[model samples]
Target chain A: MMSFVVGIAGVAVFSVLARVMQSAARGTSPVAILAIAAILSHLASVALGIIYVPQFQYWSAASIFSFGVMSYVFVFGAVYKSVSLEVLLAVAGHPDRAVPLPYIVGHQVPEIFRGRIQILIESGLVEQIGSTFAATAAGERLAARIARLRRMFAIGDSGLYDFPD
Target chain B: MVGLVTPAMNFLPGPAQTAAICLGIALPLLLLCYARIPGIRGAGSRFRIGCATAAALFAIACAVLPGERRIDDVAGGILLLATAMLLVYVFWGLLAWGFTLTLLTTLAQAGRPLTEEQWAAAYTQGGDIGKFARNRLKLLLGSGMVAVTGDTIAATSSGMAIARLARLVRLATGLR
Candidate 1:
């Protein structure tokens, strides 16, 4: 129980420390920063437990810590570029708590789409070719694997939310 | 009172632990294989099958392994199994529905550079951006995050909560 509490505290520390270190990691993703923080925090927690506890349970401490970190990552991934959530945020940000469809279609959607594209380009998964953009070789390979996985998992390629067609 | 290994773990896992560890590694390999099977449908269904198969296999390992179960050993095995499942889900979800990844796939599938208009068309497969917008909007509506009244949409109270949370996440992740 004590080790579990310590592990949970370690996750909390990791979240904050990841944020603090994110600015310095200009080239790193927040996910990467968080991962590093998780590692450091877990090690620190384990050491602290060994010194403080009469007989520390390594697996128990590790289990909860890992589960906590994975849950955090899941939440982070969900909100990171969620189009639906972005729309909610936009409407919520408005003083009137309402947003025009035109604004959403014209601005919000494009903003998110472009942002995603920019990331793709930066990561070399996509590239500009004179007048337009195309997937790079790496992108093609990645896309193929993704396509295979999606097929196995019964997902579509559209990236849109699935509604019964 | 003093021990490098916990007393519960002193007995170790024996054969059961070994098999569990082996199955954890094989989980992804199974997913990769099942992906090739045409009969499998739905990424969600396929993943669930993988996890269930893993759990069942682990169960067999526990039942067949030549030892009585120790609580710590069993607990450790369960934790290891759970970790593998979670890790696989994280990566698999990214592959299945990841926005950036799908976009890259779309462009790659296109086989050539597309003009902005062509790109949009290709991306949505003939549906305009509005449809894509509504597709996402539908998610917000389904999740009770946003309400629609005729031509306009407003965030519900829960939506506002989500908004606040998203803001905090963005700020903390330096994604602001």
Candidate 2:
């Protein structure tokens, strides 16, 4: 239990470290950064525990560390490109710290749209050709797999937020 | 008399340990079952139900598993199991409600190139982007993250709190 707690502390430390290092390595994917940080953190934490503590459970420390890192990554992924979050941030950033709803729907949402398009194009999943855009083979394969999962999960492919009945 | 420490040292699990293992295994199966329930509509609600089901099962297992209890083991197992649920939900949510993902899926499903407008139409099931915008906005409003009065929209106190947390997450994750 002590080792496990130590591991979680390591995750906390390394996640913040990764955030600081992100600026220096601008091109690196956040997931990659987090993965590397998690491994390094676990290693450092467990190593210190082994050298310092006479009785440290390696597997227990590892199990808790793994879960903590995964949870952090999950949260990072959630807020990464959240449209609703973006809207809230915009309003929160306002000088008056308030804005009109139409301003968000009219301006911010479209901006988000364009940003998403840019991401797809840059990621090589989709390409803009003339006035039209098409998905690459990689994109199609991923889309197909997502489609399958959605079907298995009974989720609609539309991706539109459905109001709960 | 010879004292032997056989490998069969702890063949039987304590009650909490048994319960933890059962709940861990049952969590995924519960999600699969809930997926088939038509009454659970939105992706958010479906994920919530899965978590709720897992929690309830864990509680029941705690009650029913027969033996001495190891509280720490049970707690650790619950954390591990809950972590798995959160991870799966994150990926599943990405596939379900991710904006960029939907765009790519729509374009791929089209079988040909589509204009920006065409893709937006396809994304919203023939409705304009406004429909999608309203849907997302409804989430923000419904969650009490943001409120609108007349033409103006403002972040509520909770919204501001959430906004701070979001920024903190962004900074901590090197997103900003």
Candidate 3:
């Protein structure tokens, strides 16, 4: 009966943790929540193990505790590194393009023409600008250019283009 | 009074019972996944049928297994192996679903509908922040579940070990 109770608690703890992580990704400070959850869950599991499982002696208890700690550390570290990198890139004024182009067109193109119709709004560039009509025209032009370039360079049909095609 | 209770009395229904419990949990989840996922429907009905058949077979096997010996010695191993394979497929499904969700969300946020190629390209990059966020959340949930389940198993096993040792010590000391 105690084991069953512990199992239910374990499931609840993990479920809450999952929801917290999702919330964090949706723009919440999830790291602190994650850390707290990990600690609480680990401790709860250990306490329950001690009560219910006769086999979880001193050595096994120590091992399990250490494993839990290590797992928490690893997960937290990975999340921190990835989230920090994403935040930094976002802050650095990178124009949010769905896909990366080889020439940094979103950033560089606007700078190149200074103030000539936003370059993004220019003919054959609208596709990258996120306007439907412009995107379609730009896409067609890009496809043609890519086909021409590939043929001119005798490139295989690998679909390689200087821009995202 | 506790000593008067037989060992068998504490042992539950064994392997067959455990398998039955898992199947009961898994079947509904599998059905939910199939019903909600449009991409899977478009890909093929065959896959869905195969999964349904597999789930039924597993359920029947669990129900028919008479005791711990039949379930643990044979069926449990096979089930574990199959579960591992299903997990791999689920991982792929999650990744694809995550990518699609991210792309759609971004486009909606930007107040536009993405073209087919753009959508395709976005998914191929595998590094969109929104998509990454979704995938990470899924992984976190998955790992968290494993950790919790493992803890419970470890705790239960430990308690059993301690009880056995106490019994042995009592026997040696002639105190029982």
Candidate 4:
């Protein structure tokens, strides 16, 4: 019975995490917020499990479980946190250029409307209109064309990338 | 003649049962890693390979260790400690890498062609990346604590359930 409960709870926890991740992806909340939520939920589950199950009282089981959970949580939180920070840095137009500005900028834009030109401008990472300026210009033109196509097809924001029926 | 009835033994998994439970836990994780890691290139590949190797080594160590050892026993406690240490080590490495990535990306976006020296200085200073990484690390570490506690509870409950089910089966078969 304890196992069944744990299984059910595990499923629930993962489901909530998936939703949280999706929300983060959609820019509903910052990645940091999502990480916090995931961590809290996981902790809650662990507490509940310990309270209800005696076998977990053993040090070995508890230790292994703790380590596994910690590892996963740390990895997820760190990765997302790092990515978000990079985005902020790129946007600030700093001189140091700590991260790969292009990748950071690319992530900021929505996938369908993304382009090198917009990324460079919006991210504020690029210092000058160098040789890559042409590529940026081309990307801008492409984006404009795509936007025009979307308007012509009456596509919604979500449907911008979809083929016209 | 019937033998004397024995008191029920509860709360511990038999050797075979414990092995099965551990394997169940490890197998899914391995499969998940395998599925998600392929097709990643470059630095990502290196990270994946490192994680995989660590996981593999840990799993092997766990397998080779004696089974059915009680946590209260010194040997069991030592094994558990070792496992915990390894897990922490792997997690820390991931966190460091993640922070590094975030820092690099942010600098790149700053619109200035930064020399490596400039980048290094910015990284060392409490620049945006540094600040963000600090905040993120705290959040991740906190969340990790929660996750670890929850997983331990869940795994223990599951293992207990398996032991109970086995007990029931033994009774049904009139083995005890």
Estimate, for each residue in A22-105, the C-alpha lDDT of model 3 and write its tens digit: 455654444455556656775676566555564333222332233334343343333332322232222222333122332222
Minimal lDDT window, size 10, model 1 chain B: B5-14
lDDT of candidate 3 over B1-176, digit per residue (tens)? 34232222132334543553455356434544554555443212423454565566666775677653542323333434244335433432322232222233333333444554443344335333333333332332333311123212111233334334544533332223
Candidates, DockQ: 0.50, 0.47, 0.03, 0.03
Chain B TM-score, all predictions listed: 0.74, 0.80, 0.25, 0.25
What C-alpha lDDT do the candidate models reach, one value each? Answer: 0.77, 0.77, 0.38, 0.39
Lowest-lDDT window of 10 residues in candidate 2 chain A?
A: A51-60
Pairs with steric clashes in candidate 1: A153-B42, A153-B43, A154-B42, A154-B43
lDDT for A68 (candidate 3): 37
lDDT of model 4 at position B149: 34
Evaluated with DockQ, which candidate comes out highest? 1
Sort by lDDT, top down from the best: 2, 1, 4, 3
Q: What's the TM for model 3?
A: 0.29
TM-score of each: 0.81, 0.88, 0.29, 0.31
- TM-score, chain B, model 4, is 0.25
The better-scoring model by lDDT among 2 and 3 is 2
Query: Where in model 1 is the C-alpha error above 4 Å?
Result: A151-155, B1-40, B48-82, B172-174
Model 3: how far residue B40 lies from native, Å: 11
Deviating ranges (above 4 Å) for candidate 3: A15-43, A52-165, B1-13, B17-47, B68-92, B95-176
User: What is the Cα-based lDDT of residue A80 in candidate 1?
Assistant: 75
